[model samples]
Target: MAKPKLPIPVTLLTGYLGSGKTTLINHVLSNQEGYKCAVIVNDIGEVNIDAELIQKTGVVTQKDDNLVPLSNGCICCTLKVDLINQIAELVKSGKFDYILIEASGICEPLPIAQSIAVLEGDEEEGTPAICRLDNIVTVVDALRMATEFGCGDNLLKDDVDEEDIESLVIQQIEFCSTIILNKVDMVNEEQLGRVKAMIKTLQPKAKIIEANYGKVSVGDILNTNLYNFEETAGSAGWAQAYDKDEDERNEHHDHDEDEHEHHHHHDEDKHEHHHHHHHDGEDHSNCDHEHGHCCHHHHHGDDDEEYGIGTFVYHSRRPFNQEKLQEFVNNWPKGVVRAKGILWFSDKDKRDYLYVFEQAGVQITATENGKWLAAFPKSEQKKYFKEYPDIEEHWDEKYGDREIKLVFIGQHMDKPNIIERLDNCLDD
Candidate 1:
């Protein structure tokens, strides 16, 4: 019998933290019609929570009958060795038709793609065949994006740079043939419009798909190659958005920056600033609406250069005052759009802790602890109380204490002032 094929196509699923890469991979693997698929999971940080979640789905195949988990450093960086070994083993197994590799959160997808592309000659004698680049599909958290990047929520950690997150998202888009905008259900009409507009600005060539819980056909995820680095290099959101002449006609420009600034002068006001004025004369007709979310490209010229300031903040330490923080949220800056992080509240009611992803002035939804307090039944609550000696009597009936960990995305936002204000909001 002839050799099956020269090289199999490998699909890459990558995104930043909590952007739903694992969710998408699980969706594809579970819904696969007949394809013999092999999945490789790469996780970051000390926890392999995503890897465990995927394994629980029963979609992950074993390596030499042993489950392969690379959960130390980033897959694109320190874990490349494990990544290669596992993929090679999967290929040699000769049981899979397609291979799906999910990169760790904070990983750069280009290196992962380059690794697969360059490994064509690494297959040993018994290995099925080499692997080739099929497609790089990057998932973006639409709701998180709307609150973090589109709106400019300056609630990120002090040291974290918001620009890095924007640049990272753009880089992921640069290499992807397909871009999955996940969490479409989290935004309102206006917030959705900003999210799509920003995505179109960043990745114009990619075939954008609206996804909820990473639900997209596996076929679309595989066997597609829309990557053209030459074309994508200069034309990505960073450049071409403001240069469209046809769009220039319907666009409106206001010279009054002072007027926009006047609306955001309050120091502790719980609201956001808004400077991108949509004039009535401007025809937003060409915009495409996917599930009521309007998306269109922008012509980036002097206007964008004047307005686009990518900022990110990474803060590991600090506790936030709930009341002051809520007031800050109530008066968030308009230029500052999105922010997602674990929040440590200091209030007697909700001081336990919570995760926050703010978009369009709404803090999406906060989840309760599932591990400790939430797991105990009413009858077992007293018994479980002994397990956690640190639990306060009143705190048990209230909430669980988590932490304030968040990723902030902002555009043209004042980093210094934002950080100062956030620091002030926290306990001394």
Candidate 2:
């Protein structure tokens, strides 16, 4: 039996508009770093502007077979099927050692990653087995990071629908494995430090690289092997906060159980003893999210607080009053940079669906994700219960697994006040 052919590695490049993605693509394609590379460029319209720009640089030619341009729509949404098909064709050719995809500026990285992940010879579409996603690299506009983050700007284009620039920017940053802080020369050291700190709070797992003119070593961006679907999926700072809180809770629970057993064996002792857990004066490590009422805060460091950057996770099982939730989002507290999570609404028509709530800058949206397990018949819910027995622990007689789990990351976050506002939005 012959060994299976290894999948060709592909690097995905994503960033906000004017973040110098085109310059970086040119750099990667021109340098190559001993690997034969094929470039797939996605642009907003029929013009294929980025590809043309790269072509003008003389690194790649328009007539070159290696340059494949995907235009007229964002790859993450409208052009997803085309993206998979293109990858299949590129892998089938076997002419390139590496493939690079430049996602449109307004696109989200998660969908692109999901599309590639599902192509492991499982779906009806004849996706080639010889393609593997290597890394997701997000380019950041260092000079603009400080100015545009909470400026309430929209990425509007003649060819594409308007999108919240701030939210899209943070989303791109949160889901990437490697972040290129491009155009660093344009910002002073203090400004750059703040930007780096902000990125750290948003995505602690991503590696940060400073660059000028979108220039970075091909070695740093290509074939780094940093893309792990599970890890990257939960790599956002908010997700990490929830994971840390759960871990601490489990540890505390075990400690309590051990203490209980010890007390049972020593009931005769008249002296009262208490086990106190000290946090070294930092209260950020505590998990307060219980019964949909806890706010889990993150401790980045002293400088983090000085910069007013903080992260908190809000968890609740209660469904939100749709009108109240909307009002709260519209009047979100100052210093909120980004907020995203699964939400449950009390509207009768919307009760069956789980909404994905997101707020970036001044823009907020709640889109239907899918039906909640509680909306399904008991027989249908049994399969999920068998697969994940822990689901029963969070299941409510009325709501099942439907809950509100949101994470907010920003500067000077009023965690207690935010929690109160969110609680007010919940249906009693």
Candidate 3:
């Protein structure tokens, strides 16, 4: 028999909106110091992540083929099976030294951590885990901490349900082995201290680090091998409710203390796709409804949204006047917490091109991505459009395959009004 390999480290990279998860990933991938790693992005978008985007950032490793996107739903809840399967695939591939699972801004980390533990135990779950939960690294936005924590009392008072982002953030802080507070440049010394204090209250166990532009030693976040599933099981307030689900799972069976200790994975062990029925008859895969910052996958078994932050996508086939777009970007709505997408700007000579935009809170960043694929010859469109099928459908004869497509996630959004305002900026 071939010599068996050691367990691969699977790190969970999580954070809230604009907390610098991508920045950290890009930083680590670009400066891997000879250590190869693969990334599994849980994209909060319409389709799987575009491979070209990662290439444009120049962060892909030799194991670029390992770029997997679980865009259907949140892996911690609705898409845990996909998470498990992907873990198995990466482990089997054995091309990467480490694997990073970057969760959405609204995900709670404990259950996700707990789910990974299931793979290691001797169980009927598919493909025995060839990897282990190495670390749970949460990238938090230091600038938003004081504000998020200030609404502490009644905001996320959902009684053990991880419905609100506030509860989710607290859970992330509590469960993580490493907490990275990014964007420290935006806050002063006194404010940073207060942010640190707030994090310490919920997560005394995590090793906290402050970073700007997501710059940090890769050694700090990867290969630490610090996760202990037993400690994870008993640590959080949100996990208490899952305990009851565990009790119900074994309520009919007889078992000893040893069995009891290892029986959590047995809850619906054979049923792979776990889901709770919803009144609207939608699976968690389809219930990505807009709330504000509190969006949770509703059809996930035991997961429901009592509070949700609104998320809206602005699409325009008409090209935006560069001056108007710049003005709007300069005065972006304060309520808009995060926004990103490709935009087509008018001005035939200098400005008639496509641009990729990223907005975190009020900060805006844009980069030219050459012309839209539709602008190229029909012979060349196949290769580019084939790489991203979801975006290809938006092509037009006059405008080619270009327009404005951005997703805004935040509170109290006026979708129709926002669309109208954006429409007013269009030259066509």
Per-residue lDDT of candidate 1, residues 234-288 (tens digit): 3443233222321342233222111010111112211111122221222222321
Per-residue alpha-carbon lDDT of model 2 for 1-428, expressed as tens digits?
23225588889999987899999998887788778788899997889989888778776664767788999998998999999988878777767778899998888998898888765554567755667888999999998886666544444445445555677788899888999999999888778778888898888889999999888888888889998877787777766665665555455643321110110111121211222222112545333334445556766776576687877777776889999987886687988888777777888898878777777776788888678777878787787678766555446665566777787888877888888898889995
Better of 2 and 3 by TM-score: 2
The candidate maximizing lDDT is 2
Per-prediction TM-score to the true structure, in the order listed: 0.53, 0.81, 0.51
- What candidate 2 gets wrong by more than 4 Å, as runs, is 1-6, 118-128, 151-160, 253-292, 346-354, 367-403
Cα lDDT tens digits for candidate 3, 1-428: 33235477888988876688877888887887866677887865556443335545766632567677778578778888888888777777767778888887667787787677766756564555577888889988887875654432323434324455654665577677888999888888766776675454334446888899889998887888676665543433223222322233235222311111111101121312222211232312111112101111112111111222334445555677888978887766644545555576777863446676766433367777566555567767766567655334434446565556565544445555666667667786
Q: What is the TM-score of candidate 3? A: 0.51
For model 1, what is the alpha-carbon lDDT of residue 158? 34
What are the per-model numbers of colliding residue pairs? Answer: 45, 5, 8
Worst 10 residues of 2 by lDDT: 258-267
- Predicted candidate 1, C-alpha RMSD: 19.6
What stretches of model 1 exceed 4 Å from their correct place?
1-4, 63-67, 121-129, 154-164, 228-235, 239-428
Weakest ten-residue segment in model 1 by summed lDDT = 257-266
